[model samples]
Target: MNDWTSGYVAEIGYTYDFFHAMTPTRMGLAALSKGVQHPFGRETFSYCELGCGQGFTANVIAAANPHIDVHAMDFNPAHIAEARALAEQGGVQNVHFYERSFADFAGSPGLPSEFDVIALHGILSWVSRDNQRLVYDFIAKHLKPGGVVYASFNTQPGWAAAMPMRRILTDHAERGTGPLEKRIDDAIAFAETLRKSGADFFANNPDQVTRLTKMRAMPRNYLAHEFFNKDWTPFHFADVAADMGQAKLDYLGAANLLDQMDELCMSKAQLEILDNECDQVRRESLRDVMLNEQFRADLFVKGGVPFTERGAVGAWFATPFALARRYSTGPVKMTWRGLEVDMAGLDYDPVLQKLSEGPATVRDLLAQGLFGAMQWADITRMMKYLVGAGFIVPCLPLDGIAERSEGCRQFNLAVCKQSEETQKLSFLASPVTGGGVAVDRMEQLFLLARSEGHETPESWALFAWQILAPQGQRLEQDGKVLETAEENIAVLQVRAQSFAARRVRILEQLGISLQPIATAQEASVASSAAA
Candidate 1:
């Protein structure tokens, strides 16, 4: 039999996690922060995700934004099948799923000729060079003019210390027997033994010892795919920029967002070094080296049009923002790399207070003098900090809000129903944000119970226990598992009460409701058609 995986890990599926950065709303905001225009500013746009593992992000985005056309392709058939099933379950009609390799996808007919936004998450550093070239060629041919691309990959310098350790693990795994998971555990065990035995390599590199400790806590499935893959190469920023430049791509900014804020990430000396550098690519590479960046999520635009200073201010003013979650009037603590952001200390109380009343544009806040004595640049930077830290989120344009809400309602119902079987999915589609909100499995169960007319928190807790008890599951609190049904229900009721007090209002603003929008017959028809 021919090996079609091309040295990629195919024995196990990837984790069912959602990455919010891949959402169009987040991408558009990242672009706007750089004073550049994103493709999704208009009513409708097309998005494509290359190597969409599990397709969770694509499906959620499509469900949230009814106006966009989403196309996602992966080389794994199992991944495509699961994605299509979820889309059908949610009555999500706007997304197309394909199972094809990079070369095949590039040559496939009857697909969209061009896309407005293309995203690649955890793909570039894992695939072989030939496959990477095929991706570049695809972008060169199919990406529309002024389109944006989000590519995340493992970066150099930070990975330098662990490179040899990774080689050792891969080599050991290849020599071992039994299943891939078993081999992975054996390799990790061997590394641990080496560390305990005071091997020269482990002694020489202290980071690997720390990394091994963290690796032990990660899921075996993630380990198999992340390390066992044969073609893992971490690229420097300049090299990746050069590869993108081949396709007429200009390095726009980082989706990580904090990297753009020099004060937050760099020391004064490092800032002076970066400031003296003229070439952007070399500067980025040197900055990565200085920070020892292990991973990167970056944006690139084809034919990018940067806004003038006045135009940028206008764009920022017109954009609306809403609180991401409930906040108290205390120290709004958020940190990035030992950099503490005291929102309260920074006098963001007025802005947060105004947003709590309702979604407010910077223009509205300025008109009300909410920012006090802050200059235009200072206010914009403060807004960026809030958005990047997830304290606040940019809202979708109010136009067509009703339709988007309906679509998201149906999709969320399907997700809540799925929580009955598995709690792997931890996000719900939010039409207002045009993205996914982090709603845990228990929260989803509460939503489901409320939709079923369970009137109180105690009732919701009881309903959730009924579903989980049969599966031999119990609630975990402070890392301790609750054994008895009474224990579980008591803990759950407390959580449900907290959710009701804090989360409900935010969910309502996000256009979520605890009411089933799709009938059984409608779901049945959708399932049959998908089958």
Candidate 2:
């Protein structure tokens, strides 16, 4: 193997927490689909991350969708081991981690074509050409009908700037004979000399120059791992489209949906000129306008599936208001549900209004509102209330609306509760703790019950009792211990009905089909038995 591939492999082995920070993206997608109607049943939804590394993204998805099974795999045995360990530590039971190469997966016999969504982040650019072909084939054979696959890779125009740097680093490595660290040091010295010579393209661009300078200042391992990757390839939009077509997948949308520059936004004359051009040319022209390089996240739908474009659901143009003038005072008058009200009087209205304009941090909202008295502590409570009310959402600021709409608070809470329950169940089933449920396990059970459907504190308490009843435990309420089977059945039935209603609403919102989990008669019998 080349030093570049060796270094890349070494880096993957050394950095165990690879892609953990990117977990929010997969989690956000799950949360966003909560109220949407999918053609597949909710429980049938599944996600697979190609080049999953240490399975950070897989763990996050499993945590978000306890009812849905997750599968994570990597060619590196060491990486898979680390991923499995992390999943076990996190008490995540929903994910099945495996050490298998793309080639092996492609050649495997009788593997079910089960995945609903396949994510390939930073994989296509780093893998060899044969591996890339295997990846495409795997997606083609494994992804279910109408499934969406997210593939992010390095793209052209941006790579125009990166290619020269790669060449410079490769030449420097060839001139040096030592450990990877010494070679990286020599490479950095060479880059600095070129920078001083002022004869390079990077030197002409201030941003690229700054980036190179900062990168050189980083650790030797970082430098060696990044610039010395052997199989790194940057492709154009047209080429990617053709590749996907070969794999029996059709481009549906961009994973970074907002970044897919709209032709409508261009001037009328420009739009008319581009209208005659091909899709590839239009896409390239748009990317040029955005100055995007390094990464392009495209979504592909399975071929032979009827996927009608939803025509931008819930898209709104934000009317920019002068924050300095409009929100400079304390308790400004705001319109809410048609009536004007003091923004401070109602706990969540002000926060909701700010979010409506666009997403803002609690600090940003406070600063914009010119609130001199209330601190973040006071504002946090109101923000939580707004999140509970489904007015405002919380998200990691990666891509604008993609993260916001998808990272729904209620859905996150549900997934979190389910994760906790799964973890507790795993522990209870383990040989340790004398095969008895731990206190923490019981607490998580109650939390899961509440999040699954129960609304009131009393309902949560009742659900908890029902869960504990199977283990010969009862709840003490109002100085009395109630352990009746009928009471347990009543609580279970009510909670199930409530959850079913919520699930229906979520399906309607997401435009997904809702399939009944059980018939009415079966549900009644199950509820009666539990009671």
Candidate 3:
């Protein structure tokens, strides 16, 4: 039988995952941070995602930003089916899903044209070169000038130390003869045996040992896609930039905010060594070498228009931001080379304290006494650092985003209802971020229960347990699978106690948690008294 998958893994699907980097709103901020004005045209805009696995990111983005028309495509029929079901569940009419390869989509008459934003979560590193060209062709013909592209892939130097081991694991996987899952397991176990037997390669590369150990603990399904794919390759930053330049695109910056910080990008000594390199691509390539960066998330623009310092600062300062979650009441700390890097003495306290109260534009943060004397450049750097540290997140200003919930509610409800059958419903749409966040199985269940009038966490937990019990499922805690009814309930009660500690607040911040309504009598009395 001739295989049409073209070296792609078709037997098992990609993870039902949502990556935050795929959102256009986030891309806009990322571009602004780099001194470019992202083309978020007012009143109307369009976005597309190539290889949108299970369509989680696409659907959620559509549901959240109802004004933006969104489109998503994946070659897997199963993935497309799930994406469509999800869009239907979310009542997300603004988005369209197509089950077609890049080639087919490129050829199809129904394909979208002039998209303002085109993104790929992990396509360049996974697909054949032919498919990659097809992707470039799609972008070349369809992307509008000033359009932004978000693409992520495995990169060189980071994957260099482990290439030999990856080859061994994949070679074993290709030689095995059972289901894809079994083959992946055999490959991992084989790698473990080599490590235990004092393999010379393991001895020479201590980092590879760390890599294999982490691999052993990773989910087999994720490993199947990561190692077993037939067309796995890593690129240097220069190579990717050159390849993308074919489509008249320019590199903006990394999707992960942390990469923006040169201090974090390399050791102090390394930065000093490469400080004189003026070429942007070469600078990034050198940084990649220092960190052994295995994976990268980057943004590109179809026709990038330069912004003057004044214009860039105006655009950047006008953007509002909010605390992604309530911060811990202490200094944010990071560890590097066995030493802790604390921001307490750096004067970030008052800024975070103000953001915690509500969303604040850069102007709002700077106008305060603590930051008033600081330059816009200095203040922006601190905010980006906070975003990189996960202490804060970029949010859509409340004024810009219209209030709408029908699509998000429907989509989240579909997700909750699906959790009744499978626990892979791991994310929910976030209106505030115009993206999705990781909402674990337990929290998903609780949210669903609450929507149905399960008053408290205990009631919600019990309600979720009743659904699981019918399917011969039980909760697990501390690696212990609770088989008995009493044990499961006990575990859920404990989980319930802590769920409110953080998850409730997070849900409220994301605008997903339903609010209590006033009683009719109260409303009537207030109306009558006013009259």
| lDDT per residue as tens, model 2, 4-94 | 2422445424332323212323223322222222223242567677778766556555644444467777776777887786566556667
Give me the displacement of residue 58 in model 1, in angstroms.
Answer: 0.4
User: What lDDT score is found at residue 456 in candidate 3?
Assistant: 64
What residue pairs are clashing in model 1? none
Backbone clashes under 3 angstroms, per model: 0, 9, 2
- lDDT per residue, candidate 1, 418-456, as tens digits? 999898889999888899999988999988877776656
Best by TM-score: 1
Q: How much lDDT does each candidate structure score?
A: 0.86, 0.51, 0.77
What is the alpha-carbon lDDT for the whole of candidate 1? 0.86
lDDT of 3 by residue, 327-381 (tens): 7577787664345655443678787788766667777776777575666667777
Cα deviation at 38, candidate 3, in Å, is 0.8
Better of 2 and 3 by TM-score: 3
